[model samples]
Target: MKDLFCLIMAGGSGTRFWPWSRTVKPKQFFKIFNDESLIQSTISRFSTFISTENIYIVSNKSQSAVLEGQTSMLYRENLIYEPVGKNTLPCIGLAAMFAELENPEGIMVVSPSDHHIHNEKLFSETIHAAIIIALENEGIVTIGITPNSPATGYGYIQTAEDITGRNSIKQFKIKQFVENPTKSQQPVTLKREDFIGTAVYLFLKYRYFLNQ
Candidate 1:
């Protein structure tokens, strides 16, 4: 069987949860809602589909000691130390580059280190579906969450068409990526189908670990 790799981006400064969330220790390594930390939960989430051996963490030099102390399951070799923070695009690109070099045909699962999923069962099922979709098609498959509100905090995706079917969820041809709008700019009557939220689960065809 081909390998499934998990790349965790944990280098964020975590400004949202400031004071508690430090530069040396981001929100990903802390647990406010659960006993296990956010990053720990993320690892557990992906570990169901792939082994810890295939799991990799990409963080900056600032958090090396904190990450080492907190993440016991993560191997020293698996911790990719990025010197500088360039943002998610560069971080993901670097992970993908390393993965492709390791195993071009492998399934690469890229996700943020910090996130709270209320629906664990549904999340797992959706990931499994994404892996299957990527494997069969041998391409990139991005997972977008079903929007529950019209809050302008998150960027929205305008769907060209709704390709939903019985039992299965709908797939859309992304018409445009809309930036966050102000409170007054928001739709007065909000509906579930108004927009698609970002869960940040990116499944790309590739494969492993390289500390930068």
Candidate 2:
């Protein structure tokens, strides 16, 4: 698994978080729970499974200085600087290029730098499983988080019948990626077990990762 690579998406300024999370310091850098900021926690959590050198953080040029200062202990070369924010698709593409340059057959894991995973062990196991599935088969793998609440703020993922798994990481033919619904179109009630795409994707093959 030396070719295994982790792409940490840390570009967003997280305007939704408001006053506390500003442009200078986004939600990912916010210390919501522990002394460690969200981005720091993300790097620390994954470092236990993957080497610091294998982890690459994709962030905007403005946030590069802050990210560098915060993640100085980690491999500095792995920090990928994006001149602009082009959303996940383009960011993933850039990371794929970097991974391919390092190792043509590299397997890349893309994840957000702001999420809070309560179960680190489970998350790691799930990610590993997804990596295996993605490598064995030519398909995109995404980690779907079981929604804890009826979040109108998040988009929902409807899994295909063939995809089956106890954990959130399951094979799904992405039915439809729904955006956050507005108040007028909001449903009366929402379920807790509803699945939502965490934007955490796994690319098993470098070619497949780059093409997608």
Candidate 3:
């Protein structure tokens, strides 16, 4: 089996949460849902398939202490810090560089550190299915959530008609990405086609930015 490297992005200041989540201890470090912090839970979710050594955290230098305290179970060297917060792309690129050097042919999984997932089993299954697609193909595989309502905050992905591929996995060719569509743009009723974007994605062999 090829190596699977997990990069947990946790560089956000989390100003949205405000007073409850401060600069030193952001939302990722907060135990809002349960005893374990969000970052810890995120690590635990990946730990089911990926080893602790293969898992890495990409965060701002400011949250060093808090991040260390929360996820001390992982290798100390796995913590890659950004001098300043440059958002998701930079964080992912920086971590991807490290992962590339370690194992250029390895699969890289990029995920946020603060998502609240209710169904762990289903989430894992979806991720595994995405991984299989990535391994067999030469493109980026992202997990999509089926939308129940017309939520403006989330970006909607309109997938192409089913091509009768992957019997178990509901796979499709992405037709287009509509970011935060207005009421006028969204359909009256979301059918079997609508899906919301989840940041969680897998890169086949660390050449994520490249095309076939």
Candidate 4:
């Protein structure tokens, strides 16, 4: 796992969870289940495989105090802070730059800091599968959750006809993304091929090998 790096995005304001999760202390810092906070659990999940040195958390500079108090196990430098919350793409781009500086060929696995995944063993397997796919295909690989309902809140992923299967983990060629469709637009029962966008991504330093 020397070439594997994990980037956890923890900069969300948690405005959706207003009453409990404030700007001062977002939902990521809250201990939603058990003793560990959401962010802590997230870190722990990746720590099972990725070294502590390779796991980095990106959040707003304002949350430094809370982040420090919560995740003291991390290296001081690993806690990357943005001057302001520029949202997901910029946050990820910043971490990608950091990973590239450390190792140009490193495979960066990006995840959210607030997700609650129950099955740790399966989660690790899925991540490793995605990493293998990314390295073998030299492209971006994402984990898509099969949506059980026609939920309009989350974006939907449409996959192409082609499928790549390895070690029981199947990879699909993404056709397009349907962002938060209305009830009229979404089918009452989703097709087996469709999936909800979970934002979990694995890619090799923004395709660094392309330059070679």
The CA lDDT of each predicted structure is 0.74, 0.76, 0.77, 0.79
lDDT (tens digit, per residue) of candidate 2 on 1-212: 67888888999876879877777678998788999999999888878777787889999888877888899867877888887788888888887888788788877888889988788778778878887777778867777766545566666666656666555655566665567755553353243234454545555676786676
TM-score of each: 0.85, 0.86, 0.87, 0.89
Better-scoring candidate (TM-score), 1 or 4? 4
> Which 10-residue window of candidate 3 scores lowest in summed lDDT?
188-197
How well does model 4 score by local distance difference test? 0.79
Model 4 pairs in collision: none
Q: Model 2, stretches more than 4 Å misplaced?
A: 165-171, 184-201
lDDT of 1: 0.74
- Write down the RMSD of candidate 3 (Cα, Å): 2.5
Instruction: Summarize candidate 1's per-residue lDDT along 1-212 as a digit string, tens digits.
Output: 33788889999887878988989887998987889899889988888768887788899999888888878887778888887899766787777676666667677888889988888887887777777776766456667765656677666666667654333645655666666766764573234364666666777665322223
Residue 8 Cα positional deviation in candidate 1, in Å, after optimal superposition? 1.1
Over 64-117, each residue of candidate 4 has an lDDT whose tens digit, in order, gives 899999988899899999987887677877887877777777888889899888
Per-residue alpha-carbon lDDT of candidate 3 for residues 21-99, written as tens digits (9 for 90 to 100): 8777789999989999999999999998898888989987889999998888999989999988887677877877887
Better model by TM-score: candidate 2 vs candidate 4: 4
After superposing candidate 4 on the true structure, give the runs of residues whose Cα lies further than 4 Å from its correct spot: 188-192, 207-212
Task: Locate the minimum summed-lDDT window of 10 residues in model 2.
Answer: 185-194
Error of 2 at 31 (Å): 2.3
